[model samples]
Target: MPDARDKAPLLGLGLVWQQLAVGQRFRSFGRTVTEHDLMGFVALTGMQEPLFVDATHTGALGPRPVPGALTHALIEGLLLRGMVHGTGLALLETHIRPLAPVRVGDTIHAEVEVTAIRPTSTGGRAVVACAVRVRNQRDEAVMDYDVTRLLRGESTP
Candidate 1:
């Protein structure tokens, strides 16, 4: 993390959108997942799966697995927070593939690639496709998928 004195100026939404291009990639700052983060997500989403709630019940998958949705949300949030904070209009769709379990205390990073960009029927909006690969400190991929979002253009009306 950059120190306060070393921080760069924030980019505006227009400049952010202008920089989008297929094949461009970016990495969000890493975050260590905590038990509180996981439990809060479960409570907020009402995910009653034993795998997410009980660590004592050791199954074939071992201890309770952090909810996949929470992982996806965190990955997306990191990406947006770093590059396009307050710029996105709506998340059109998301598809997540969990390859490994994300346990508490694991520091994960989100790697994003701009896969596709399509202009919408309305000149003021565009569909952006981001391919996200989430990996832990060990560098093992925990999740991979694509997310589509609607981005507003200069014409907001």
Candidate 2:
């Protein structure tokens, strides 16, 4: 008898590795940054940097900068519903560059582009490289990065 925890979800069959293509681009739905989101990130990741946690702390740098990693996660969450929509196999790596500051009430969107693809040596999976850019409501880039994900495929006999 299989436990419920061991069962895969109904949508488990994501886009197969072979169905992916390089140069494809996706735009994620917009998400607005909030105080709760920022604070929750502090609680979730133990990131208590003043730039993100200190409400009154403001400098020439603009509103307390939203944690870069949090921004990345939120923007990526939007992508997951559409751009990165699929049963993800694994996140191989993420390289991020914080370009600008994000603050409360800022609406953000992600632009994801498939950069490269290669089959795993076993021929049952593939590694996909994607370039992601997160932009604020002002149309300014807040963060940019590249992520590599492993995609599942049909099993070989």
Candidate 3:
């Protein structure tokens, strides 16, 4: 349990972070899918199929078949970048599903919730668990999952 004075202050501004409780929902930004995003993936894993590259192939089916990585990126990368504050920690887990083909201009966002936050029993740190709903611009539920991240208190230095 954190002491009354153990609240971690926000970086720069010195405002105390409101250690979020369960069921806290946060709105995350949505952006149009772009080529640059996939280039990195190709560079890392090598573009192997036209389904992920050739729009013609994607259009053959209907919409562009968005890379699964994009769905994971939105849910894991930018989604909760701002949701958790005062926790000097990194991501521990993430899972997502691509419900439909997403095109180059398709936009998507995350609906997030803070499911749990508690002190790390052995390390004197905090662990936060959350559930995320990744939705497309059409307001369709494309994916959902739970995640956990570690946090540290101000006392850590």
Candidate 4:
């Protein structure tokens, strides 16, 4: 008989705080940015910049330059889905630096490296710091950021 554990849902659970270690690295699955994604984000955020909403307006990066905020949100979505999910408590801080422009149709993913881990003053929680690099389909880095998050410990409080 097959054990029920063998049939566990794929990617249904997130890594608890203890499972993460400094110097550990991971790559998230890729997501392609589409025109619809750009349009929707622009509409929702009210970011009506010509570079994002105007197809005819050509910026330094050329036409269809997606907003840097959109790119960051997409990468953060990937990280949340793939790494933190239910185990993440809160976002403590983030420092973002845009390296290059991301246009529609550019598939992107995050390369993450755990930089620090420290137990919180409260039991059953910890602070985790990570360096994230967002890259496009051409393997060009589009953004770099350091994220600090509060994660749940494996043990119940």
Order of the predicted models by lDDT, top scorer first: 4, 2, 1, 3
Per lDDT, the best of the predicted structures is 4
Query: Per-residue lDDT of 1-157 in model 1, one digit per residue for the tens?
Result: 7698656755543323545888999888899989899889989989977887886868666675687788888887787777666668888998889999988788899888999988788656778898999999999999999888877665652
Model 1: residue 10 alpha-carbon error in angstroms: 6.7
Off by over 4 Å in 2: 1-14, 83-86, 154-157
Candidate 4 worst ten-residue window by lDDT: 6-15
Off by over 4 Å in 4: 1-11
lDDT of 2 by residue, 74-131 (tens): 9777766654356467789999999988888999998888999898898588888999
lDDT of each model, Cα atoms only? 0.80, 0.81, 0.66, 0.92
Model 1 scores worst on lDDT over the 10 consecutive residues at 9-18
Task: Estimate the overall C-alpha local distance difference test score of candidate 4.
Answer: 0.92
**lDDT (10s digit) by residue, model 4, range 51-137:** 888889977899798989999999999999889988899999999999999999899999999999998887789999999999999
TM-scores of the models, in the order given:
0.83, 0.83, 0.75, 0.91
Stretches of candidate 1 off by over 4 Å are 1-15, 154-157
